[model samples]
Each structure stands twice: as C-alpha cells, then as structure tokens.
Target: MTVSSETRGLAVVTGASTGIGAATARELAGRGYHVLAGVRRDRDADAIRGPGLEPVILDITHPDHIEALAARVHEDSQGRPVRVLVNNAAVQANLPIEVFAIEEWRRMFEVNLFGQIAVTQALLPALIRSKGRVVNISSVGGRVAMATYGPYAATKFALEAVSDSLRRELAPFGVEVVVVQPGAVRTEMLGRAIAAAGDLPAMTSEQGQRYSGLVRAINNQAVSSTNAGLPAEAAAKVIARAVTARRPRTRYSVGREAALVHVVRFLPDRMLDRILAAALRPHSAVTT
Candidate 1:
C-alpha cells in the first residue's frame, strides 16, 4: 500500500541528480514525505522519479524555473504542506584566487549563493505558511577558506552568513533555518571540480609558478579526503534530522572533519595558517 503525503507532508530537494541531494530525496521519500526532487536534465528526472518521489526540472539560477517550482508547491493536488526545502544545488572549482576570472567567480556565486537565495525566496511563502524548515548545504570551506578554494569558499562563507541572518529572522515566525556543513564526501563533485579546473584558461607562467604546487596539493588532498569521507547517505541523514528534529540546531556538521573544522576555526589566524600549510606540505612537493 502506498502512503499519502497528506499525513507526512512534502519535501523539496534541489540538485537531486546526484550525490547528497539524490540521497536526501530518497531518504525523505523513504521516511514517508512526498518529495519533489529537482534536477536539470530529463535523464536525471527519469532516474529519480518513483513512488513518493517526483522529479522536477529546475535550474536554480533561472527565474522561470524558480517560479514554476513555487507554483508546483502551491498547486499540489494533495494540498500537502511543504515540510522542508533543501537548497542543495551548487558548483565547485579548485583554482587559485588569481586564476579565477571575474566571470568564473560570478558563475560560482550564481549557482552556489544567489541560486540558493532565489530558491529560498521563491519558496518562503509556502515554507512560512507550513512553518517549514530551510536546509542549506554549506561546507567546511565556509568556516576555513583553504588555499586554492577561494571562490567556492567565498560563496559558502556568504551562505553561512545568510543562514545566520535567516535563522534569526525566521525564529519568531515558527519557520526554521538550518545550515548543514559537510566536509569531504564521496561524490562526483570532486571529479567535476578537477575537470572544471582543467578547463580554465592556461595560467600565466608567473601565476603557474606561484600556484602550481599548491593547486596540485589541494587537488590531491581533496581526492584523498573524499576517498576516505562518509557516503552521501550520512549527509542525508543529518539533513533529515534537521528537518524533523523538534528543536533542531541552527547548524549541523555532517562529518567529523566538519566537526573539527568548527573547533579549528577558533585558533589564531597565523596558527591556523601554519596548520593548514603543514597539512598540505606532504602533497605540495613539486615534481620536475
């Protein structure tokens, strides 16, 4: 027998094509919520569509998509209240701060920060009406901006700030805003970031010389960390908890690395710098 969303309510998860987003969609659906999983491609839509899970084509940066998503939520046949909105869509690239062109910086922010805000804005009415939660997927980078992670971290850092402000603003209205910070997770995002980094214009010789080893080290470290990191299911569980907890924390760290990052962020700046440098040194050895 199929369960009805009238009893459990609804969940909307963006970037449901892969990784943490996909897992969260399935997790919510399994837990009996009717989930609208947002993906960008027809194939991804087909892949994620099933009982208790409906896939919607959404590109968060597009106003029409955002508008349509809001309409879908408002016009649900079952009239199930939206229980949670998971703003999980994002893009990543590993490049030195100087190597990232202004356009690249804007593009990352478009997807990572602004896109999230747009979705949240569009759904806020329904969320407020249902007293629903907003779950923003940030990162450890939000707390500590690592070398060669400038653009991505900048967006996440901004998101952390936004989540703080939103949480405070929504508290009185019964709606909650929660931020989930995940460290390295086994996801295709690592491979995509590596490929995207390779696709950028060739670095100037001077710029390359200054950053080549650091970039390589960051990439190497990312690969190693992701290989050892928790699977997407772990993150999904944390997100689900944030959605369901009667007294959810304002922020939840998905992995031990993320938990450690929270503590490490309190260290003196120079001390933190030295620790970060030391962590990367083994991977930074330049090869002829």
Candidate 2:
C-alpha cells in the first residue's frame, strides 16, 4: 500500500466549482496529487486556479463532456494512472414526495446517481490501472428519511447502495470504493435548497393555509440547522482522507448530527415521525 510521491497520480473531483467539492479539490492538491477540478462552468475552473490544480469543464449529464474527459485523461496520464474519483455534484429541490415534479426529480437523479455512474464508467480504465480510490459523497439524508426532502434523499440512498455494490465488484480488481455521508455543512446549497422549497405551488386550499406556516417553519429550521452543521472545509478534509488513505473505510460519517440521524433511522418509523413532528412544530403553533 505504499504510494510514492511520484507515483501518486491525478485525482478527479466533480462539482469542484464550490462548496465541499472545491474544498476537497484543494485538500487533495495540497496532499501532492495533480487535481482535476470538474465543474459545469468555465468560470468554475477559474476558482481552482493554482499549482497542481487543473479546472476541467464537466457537466456530468453531458455525454460529450464525459467522453472528452476520458480522452484528455488518457493523453495527460500517458498511461500513468488516475488515482482517485470524487462524485460530488448534487442538487436538492425539496418538495413533499407526493407532489414532487417528475421532471425535477429526474434531474436530481441525473446528477446525483447517473452522473456519478457515467463519470465512474468513463474513468474506470484509468482507476483500475492504478488500483485507485472512488469516494461517493452521500449525505445524512441518504441514511434517514426526512419529510420535504425525499427526492434528494432517495438519490443519496441509491448512491450508498451503489457504492456498496461497486466496492465489492471493484475489490477483485484492486479499486477501493468509499461512501462519505456528511450531515449538513455550511455551503451555498443550503440557501438554494431553501429557496427551491419555498417556490413549490400550493397543493390544496387547506394545504395552502398549512403550507404558508409550514414553509416558514421549515425555512427557519433549515437556515438555523444548516448554519450549525460542520463547515464544508471540514467535510472536504474527510473527503481528502477517503481519497488518499492507504486503507480508506467503506463508509465515513461526518458531523455529530449526521451520526444522530443515523441513530434515528434505526428507531421505529412511528416514533421517529412523532419526534420529527414535535421537534419541527412551529413556535407560534405551540400557544397554550
């Protein structure tokens, strides 16, 4: 398991434009690997500017981009090796699962699940050659069901399962697969997700009345809770370990809340539901 400085190859990190992905890219680059910062915009590439950091435009949903990346990797590596892949691009548009838009749900799946697969498949040849590492960035939502965020969590759950299967499948070939489930982190995604949740149309006249109050409570909770979670840089440090550790774990849970949520997942469904309902009850709704 000796990885010499010269032999440590390129580490490809998707969603590297900002947040955890960006931090992870910097962390990896600092650790001596040549880093590819995969982002959807050319401007995103500019964000990763520095020694050993290469910004590559990679919108995971685009086949052309995926293919081009593989070609470029082969050329750059010159048959050396690709030592790591971090699948971190994700979007969360929270709505009650019953009323979630099919199109929006599909879009989340495309980036959260299929995009990860597409990138991995394209890079498999190089990873196998190097016996490299694959770190799938899941979330606490993946381990437990949370109301109003089912669409996003479903994909993370699938990612956790897929990471398990891939770990077994790739073990024979020497590639290691690790799943990193971070709780909430201070990132731009929290604000965007909160805004998206508020934009959903009223489901019913009664629900509309219900929705206004509920949305306010949810937004407040999200703002406060997300603000309280670990910083994206801390999560990125965990991701960096997954990438470069000699024996990376199959699953690494980051943040205290993340661990608590995993415990909540094991509780009886009814009990957990009641706990959430009580915990989330709006302050105004608790009048004597």
Candidate 3:
C-alpha cells in the first residue's frame, strides 16, 4: 500500500530504545504510520519522542506494563486501528550452557520468549479487529546455534517455532505472523554480550580454562561480523516492508550471514558442524 498518515494505522514496536527496534519505530513513522515505540526508561522515551513516534514505557516481561500498553492501544483517542506489533525486545548472553545459572536461562526466556507471547496475547483483540500483522525479530542464531550462544539461541529457536504455530492458527483470522532473522548488525547488544561473556566468575577454574578461549573467539567473531554487518536502518527497512507488503513472506533474512545460514541449514549436521567450527577457529587465540 499507500504510505499515508491518513490511511496508515498505529504500529507498536517493542524494544524501541535503540538499535533495530528504534530504527524500525522511526521507519514506520516515516512511512506514515503512528508508531508507539516501547522503551523501558524515561530518557529513552524522551530520545525517541518526535513526529509520528510516541514512546510508551513497556517492559514486556511485566504484566502491568503489558496491560498498560494493550490499554493504550485499545483506548487510542484518534481511533486508529492497530496495524502491526513488532516483537523486538530481547536479551543476549554468550556463556556456554554449563556456565549460566538456571535463573539466568529462565530470565532469558522470560524476556525473549514469554514476554513476546504475553504482549501478543494482550494485543490480539486489537490486531484481530484490524486484521494486522505480527513481526517477530529473530536472529541467525535461531537457525544456527554457535558455541557460547546456547541460551540466547534457544530462546530464538523457540520463538521461530511459536511464530510458525501462530501463523497457521491466525491465518483464518486474516492476521499475519512474520519472522525476521537478522545476522550481525551494528547494535549495542553486540558490545554488551561481549562484555557479559568475559565474566568468567560464573565458571569453575577448569571450566574457565576450557571455555575462555572459545568465549574470546566468539567475541572476536562477533566484533568482526558486526563491523561488516548492515546498519540498523537497513534491517528496519526490511521490517517496514514486512509490515506494509501486500503479500509478505513468512520469513525475511536481513543480512548476507542470515541468508547464508538459511542455505546452510539444509546441510548435513556434520558438514554444518565442520563449517561452523572452521569459521570460529581463526579467532581462537588463547589469552591469559
């Protein structure tokens, strides 16, 4: 369609404080949709508030915050129909499965998986009324879980599955569910994950010795890949297309790495393993 504010309805984007989510909110607004950009902090709210963008305090994990967001959508004074819900709030940690505490794993799922579901459930009525779409921001990790990316990848994998089921279930209602898998992008999350991975206090001495080099390798690969990755605005454009396209694809890959993962996923497990290991080997310089 037409990219006109008079015709476009409201779009809700979670995790809009920075990176892909922030860029997406801006993009949708620029395309003439009134965007309710979700942010956790007042400063971020202030930062993203302008033009067609309205910042909403939404911590998707908190029921109250989600309820408030749903209420806001239902009670729009302008009577704008809900057009899209972009589930972009997520957390990343690069520790190995054995390194993370049970609580940490649960927290990751809480934010990445359950939080998205809760928000979707709360807003389903509005979406159904408008026959809108759901855009989930997954990652290449969703299809290919690398060393030290277990917890975060697990959540994305589950989200991919959920999107599949939701898509089929919502088809009869005219609601579309689309998954966007993005590879390395220039985002603050990469630096945060690298910093978090360097925390070896969670590992035993022997465990640290065994995995520290792997962690460092992963960090190095992350940095190099992200340095060569697309800008957040590029991914935002894809998401905006997913939002506005008349016949959107079920899944959209944002970067070259993501497209490569799509092709490689069909390879034999052993072959994929060798490829992934070889890719990481170049960065595996042991450091004390």
Segments in model 1 whose C-alpha atoms lie over 4 Å from true places: 1-4, 286-288
Q: Supply the global lDDT for candidate 3.
A: 0.92
Model 3 segments beyond 4 Å from truth? Answer: 198-200, 286-288
* Clashing residue pairs for model 1: none
Give each model's clash number: 0, 0, 0
lDDT of 1 by residue, 13-61 (tens): 9999999999999989988899999999999999999989999999999
Error of 3 at 138 (Å): 0.5
TM per prediction? 0.97, 0.91, 0.96
Clashing pairs in 2: none
Q: Model 2: how far is 1 from its true place, Å?
A: 18
Predicted candidate 3 versus true structure: per-residue lDDT over 186-270, tens digit per residue: 9999987766655535679898898878888888888889999999999999999999899999999988887766687579989
Which pairs of residues have clashing backbones in candidate 3? none
RMSD of each predicted structure: 1.7, 3.0, 1.6
Question: How well is each residue in 97-191 modelled by candidate 2, as lDDT tens digits?
Answer: 76677888898899999999999999998899888889999998888766777899999999999999999999999999999989878899977
| lDDT score for candidate 2 against the true structure | 0.83
